[model samples]
Target: MHMIENGNVAAALGVRRCRVNVIAAYPITPQTPLTERLSEYVEAGEMKAEYIPVESEHSALAVCIAASSAGSRVFTATSANGLLYMHEQVQWASGARLPIVMCVVNRAVGAPWNVWNDQQDSISQRDTGWIQIYCSDHQQIIDTVIKAYWIAEKVSIPIMVCYDGYILSHTYMPFDLPDQDKVDAFLPPFKPDYALNPDEPASLNTVTLPDVRVDVRGELAHGYMEIRYLLQEELRKTLAVAAEAEKRFGDIFGREGDPYLESYRTSDADYIAVGLGSLTYQLRVSVDALRKEGIKVGILGVRFYRPFPDEAVASALKGKKAVIVFEKALSYGYEGALASDLKSALYEHLAGTGALPAVQNYILGIGGREIHTDHLTQALRAAIQGSISKEPVWIGLKL
Candidate 1:
């Protein structure tokens, strides 16, 4: 069962020189191999780092938070329900502004017991204030990890490099591994804007009332609004920060990826299929097939999720006839989250500029259901052929 080109192993080795000084994780299906491989590399002396095997997912994140607070670059991996269990600490990591990088193998949350790919577990936490980057393939899985540190440390926020469980995580493909010297030159030691220093000795995570609090210079300020504004401004700047990181990564690696969104064949197409994660790969293949049949269909693959790339999406879908948002998770009572967010992003463009393209959302994959080429192709063809509604459309339903 040993595969020479497994994506998880390739990604682990690809970012091996990031110098992860600490790792704290608990084993979970589909994501277990990722941490396991890191442990192997550490034991084999490939990476000089401290590996902390924790008892539960909650403690896994707790350990990372402690290490990062002390100013050490940390790493971890988890999937499905494990990520759900770390939900509380997930917010704490971002609120404390520790730039830790973790690999999220996107999987379905279970009650009936399932181990499969779905974005629901992570997608539901879209408001966690961490930079969420979704990957389409194994190559991206590795490349994004290194870029994540650059982006996170630059903006002082955490990042989750998410890949579809089993799809990109377990698949095998040949990929390039960066040299250690180049990586060292690219990423330096962790220098936080602030850290938990014993000598400095400041209050960490102190609660605030509506009244007052002391600032660093002993000035009075509204702690709640001040911290909230700081978090918001820093989050808004993550888009540009990630873009700059991608530019630097490209300069060294000779491959450029837009941190927000990537458009394909949109300049001349009439319809665009907006997709994320592994589903974009299938959507691209189907779009090619649809093109061979003389249909003009393009693809817009969403890479960044948290800081939604409104401008990039608006630019790509400006002159299109219609846009079909292929969503992997539903927003429960509000239709597809990506679809609703995209609609909001395009409203200004439609009002300011010329007529914007028609937008329709389709919930395709949920609860670990399979999404194939025929399902995507047929739905796209239907939308292009007739008048599709602006509301969210559910694809591949059997009822």
Candidate 2:
């Protein structure tokens, strides 16, 4: 079925197709419409799910946390400060190894209180043990929402299907609304590895000692450190599981692939531009312009941000002359997080093989600042001609 809809509604329709059992959310700018549509679906008896409209974003995710622990397919959405409000549970959900899928409509975290688009909100939460998948457009938003469920369930980790607020959330675009039958065929119902069942009363996520301990049943249980170690190991394995999920999704829906990195003309390019979310797709304009001028440049979208696609990034970027990275979020004093991580991956992957590419970092569009394609073209052009900066460049700054 072909339907033209905003990214929010696209996500709502995808969630409906997914047969999500529990939908809990609180309204925030750019993200409010996504949950509002879900609430309508639940109230109108169109979708058979519990839409719990909580008072605050914290409680919204807490509802998901509780519902997911009880073996329900749960979902929630938040942006900027709201996501920060649920920071504790953000860590808790993944630490508990619950397959809860969330849509993080990316927005700038407020200091002076602006309610516009940026990737900083989700970017800040990257260390919180959740698998973050950034989307480029409405199609990826809907498709990734469906695939997120499959991947999360396989790895038993929470996933943030992140996209820039307003940029993708409110923009109207045509995406194939996947058939309900195919979605049913692709995603199995949530059968948790363990849940809070009264019939089989068991202690879950209780206080742990420093080291390994024996439980009441004389079973060797993981301690605090051991549990953390297991989460780390499972997150690392998520890359492979996510790849398999993408393959199954492509086979069934035919709109999803390359779970880690989405490359645009990078095959025979010397300089590659890397970024996340819709900006990566927009950067292709610059790539095309540069190509016409006989400058070999390309765009690499880092899809799976957390678990950091070390090998995929290293493989895509190693042989390039310079990897120009543009980001919407900055890591305070340091460079853009994506740029820093890419450089680190290159260091490890190109240790003995070849010289590392000059990873030039540029921070732009923070707090809803306007990003122009020509700006990208000029930045890459400078890098290609060996005119670069060791420090991160802040684009469109007013001194």
How big is the positional error of residue 231 in model 1, measured in Å on the Cα after superposition? 0.9
Instruction: Please list the C-alpha lDDT of all candidates, in the order they appear.
Output: 0.84, 0.91
Instruction: Give model 2's TM-score versus the native structure.
Output: 0.98
Name the regions of candidate 2 deviating beyond 4 angstroms: none
lDDT score at residue 8, model 1, on the 0-100 scale: 74
- Which digits, one per residue and each the tens of the lDDT, describe model 2 over residues 338-372? 98899889998997787678888899998998988
**Per-candidate RMSD vs. true structure?**
2.3, 0.9
Which candidate gets the maximum TM-score versus the true structure?
A: 2
TM-score of 1: 0.95
Candidate 1 steric clashes:
0
* Model 1 alpha-carbon miss at residue 9, Å: 1.7
Which pairs of residues collide in model 1? none
Provide the TM-score for each candidate, comma-separated.
0.95, 0.98
In candidate 2, the residue pairs with backbone N, CA or C atoms under 3 Å apart (3 or more residues apart, or in different chains) clash, namely none
Clash counts per candidate, in order, are 0, 0
